[model samples]
Structure formats: structure tokens, C-alpha cells
Target: MTTNILFCGDASMTDGVLIATLSLMKQTRHPLHIFILTATLTVNGHHYRPFAAGTAERMTKLMQTQNSAHQLTRIDITDLFVADLPRANMKTMFTPYCMLRLFSDLVPELPDRVLYLDTDVVCRRPFDTFYNQSMAGVDIAGVLDHYGKWWFHHRLAWFDYLNSGVLLMSLAHIREDGLLVRCRQLVRHRWLFMPDQSALNIKAKFKRILPRKYNEQHQLKPDTVFQHFTTFFRFWPYFRIVTVKPWQIQAVHQQLGLHEYDDLLKDYRQLAPKLKEVS
Candidate 1:
């Protein structure tokens, strides 16, 4: 069933978020209208530089491979780069947040009630039910914030900040309220506080917050649909995350058949095997 659209941004390079977004897209039960754009910048008045055209192409290939289930195709939605959005440019640091800010501003072109998900989130269920809701009255719907550190809480105007990593955004409010500007103000001030999450807090003071189950990822998740891999997301979700931190260079080196901790060589060797087998 073709349902309300759910959009997320993508970069030229396929980072952890792109991989996670594709994984979650595969898990969507109904036919999904997912939008993927890049937050590229215009260096000068004449030059156009995207986050990574090659990387975006690679991400397209990866998404196309799952065509049987998700069947997503790459398309260029806009030429607006990260720098053109005026005060909303704070989103460049936390890429996904900026992408959503773009979505909010451009909701007139988007489906009525769509879910704007971040790349770090993994889906455990079909997101159809979340789409068919009426967000006209409700402002925003996202997971409850997960305080990464003690100092994180103090940075916000209030303690209740929803996680923007995964959430349902209402296209109508995005165009009307002009919340993105306020949210960007927070981001520009390094009110970057919790990165993108802090910007959502700035919006949440006036915008409504979604329940916690949508992006649940801490401890035991009995009723969560997605898991936001914050700083503590060191292990794979479904895979039995072995007693190893994925960031551990030694562990990564051994897995990639690397002779040493060579950043350039390790990335190629590590990801090459996985892509080869899958391809």
C-alpha cells in the first residue's frame, strides 16, 4: 500500500546513518514513500559541492539492492544547500536535524503527515500506522530524549527534550509556525547543547512531544519500534553484539584482515568484504 511519505536526508558518503536508514527502510511493512536528499553546500556563488556525489551514488546502490522489499530509488528533491537556509544552517553540524528542518520548511511539497527519521535509528516494525495520523493539531512526534551525559540536561531551557533522531513530523505546522528558525537559534548558539536533540527541545517548548516508544533504545526495549543509537550505541542491534565496542580499532582491524591500524586501508578492507558478499 502506498502510504503517507517518510523522508530522511542522506550524505554523499554512506555513513552509519545511511546504513541504519536503509536497514530500517527494509523493515517498513507497507509501501513507503521515503525521501532522501543531501545537505550539500555551495562553496562560492558559482560552484556546487554536495556532501559527496560518489558517496550518494554508493548509498543509492545500497538502497537499490533492497529493491525487492523497500524498493527505494534515488532522486534529487532540491538544489537548496545547507548554507542557503538563513538561520537554519546550524543543522549542518547535526546533519539529520538540518535535513528535517528542510523538510519542515518545505512541507508544502511533502505528504501531509510524514515521519522524518534520522539515520542512526533502526526499525523493528512497519511504520504505516504512524503515517496515517493527523498531526495538524499535534506539532511534532519524536522519542523522549536520552541524556547522554549529566551536563547535557543543563543545556536545555527545560528538562523535557524529545529525541529528533526518529520522529513523526507534521508538514502543515512546519510551514505555518516557523519553528525551524527558533530551533536553529538554539543550534547556532552551541545551544548545540545536545546537538540536534537540543534544537528539538527548543521546538518542544511550544511543539508537542511524541511518546517514548517510537525511538526507544536504552536497556530493555519491550515496546519500542526503533532504537536511537546515541553515544552508547556501540553494538549492533539485532546481531548479538559480542563483547566488543565497534569503535575499538583493534577489533575493527582484526575483522578487516588489516596488518595495522591504517585508516585508509582498514575502511576499504573492512567494508569491501561485506559489500562483496552482499553484492
Candidate 2:
């Protein structure tokens, strides 16, 4: 059986998306049918940049050379729900790309189930571990958001708020129950800071919760299957905190001893040029 995987990102995030894709393909045991959600800058002043030409072709060539079953498909459904996106409580860190997962229903030919992952995560274990596991009867399966759990539990009174970074979606269930529509309604009516994630959590509060190892963050563990570089903020080993990403220039590297990850990104840096800016 083919494992359907989904990812969302834009020009600025090209590096993360490529690294994440290559890393996953390196570990997945099953054949992969990958779907990429993207957007163009529709509104004046809207910041989204279109995917570089030949992006999908390059990805497919890279994956197919390794395994014929690896396929890459890119779809842009920005116009489907662009107006429905929330604004009042939207977080500055979020862009239209963050809301792409909400429009999964409109993606014409998605499989019955698809695993959605943030571009920031790198795969270290066979994806079958996640794909093979049953979703039971839930619309979504995801790891609890350790970063936002307390706020969700205390403020929102939700017991099962999930990290949207790594999720297994039951597309059939989502369509059958009109879950995405309900999620959109929740986004419009509720006070949400992380709009898409909060809407999913509040609408599907009973979603299946996976083990922490599935979406492990920052530090790696022996059993961690996915190393999620979820945070861009780097705290000093002893004192101060700074913001840095592994792919950025060394001017931001902290002495916090995370060079191991920076070096990992360097190994895949050769592929970065494929995502060059439109300018």
C-alpha cells in the first residue's frame, strides 16, 4: 500500500521542506505518494511567494531515483479558503501556508488517509510506524502539544489539544463529519491564537493522542522517531535566550551545543538552491 504524506510551505521555508522530505524518504519503508500544498501571493501586500519552477520535478527525480514508488504532487488551493481565514486573533508567526491543511478536503485526489507533517520536522524512523497504526475512529491523530498544552487545558478547557506539526488525518472521516467546515466555523467564532491548530483541537478535542516520541522536539532521544525542530528560539545553556535556525548563517549560532543539528542541515544544503527566491 502507498503511504500518502502531506507537507505545506512557501519560498521562505524551502530549505526546511526539502530537508524534511529527504529525511522522511530516507526512513520510510513503504512507497510514498507525497502531496505538497502551496500558494501564490494573491493579495497585494500578501507575502506568499510561488513555488520555484521545476520544484516538483526535482523532488520526484530525487525520490524516484531511490525508489520508483516515490511520487511527488504539488497542489495550490489558496483560493478555496483564503477568505475564510481568521485574522483578529491570528498569530504573527502564521501565514496562509499555515492554514493549507484546513483545505485538505479540496485537494481533488487525496487518499482516504494522509499524514500531515510540518516542514520543520526531520524523520528518523520508518513512517510505517505512524501510517500502520490505526486511527481507530477519530478524525485526526497527533501528539499532544507540550508547548501549548497548559494554555489549552487551563484557558480553553480542552483535554486533547494537539501539536499540528505532525498529524495523521483520516480524510474520509474529516469529509464525512464535515470536520473541516466545523473547524472553519470554530475559527470564525472562537478566540484562537493559533487559528488552524486551535480550531482543530477545539473541534476534535477527542482526537487520538500519539506517544511523545512520535513528535519529539528540540532534543533527540534514543527512541525518538521524528526530531521536530519546533522552536526557533534558542536559550543559552546557562543564561540568555536568542533566536536562531539551524539553516541560518552562523552569526546566530549559540553555544548551546546544537551544532550537531546545524551540521545535519549542512549535509543537505546542496539541495537548497532549488528553492531560490523569486527575485
lDDT of 2 by residue, 1-279 (tens): 888889886767777777787777778767888888887754436666755547777878878878998898888766765667654434445675777788887677788899898877778777686777877678999888876775576333555668988999999888888888887777656666787887788777347888888997656687888877665444455554443444563642453355545645665777667545436
The parts of candidate 1 lying over 4 Å away from their true place are: 1-18, 42-103, 107-109, 148-159, 185-191, 233-279
Residue-wise C-alpha lDDT for candidate 1, range 1-279, written one tens digit per residue = 654434445442334444455445556655544555454444224342333445544545655565533434334544443433434343344444244444355534565566666554556565666666566666677655665433445344655556676767665666567666665555554535345566665565345556666776564256666655455433454444332222344754564332322542344445533443131
On the 0 to 100 scale, the lDDT of residue 154 in model 2 is 32
Query: Candidate 2, clashing residue pairs?
Result: none
Using TM-score, give the best candidate's number: 2
* Estimated TM-score for each candidate: 0.61, 0.86
Highest lDDT scorer: 2
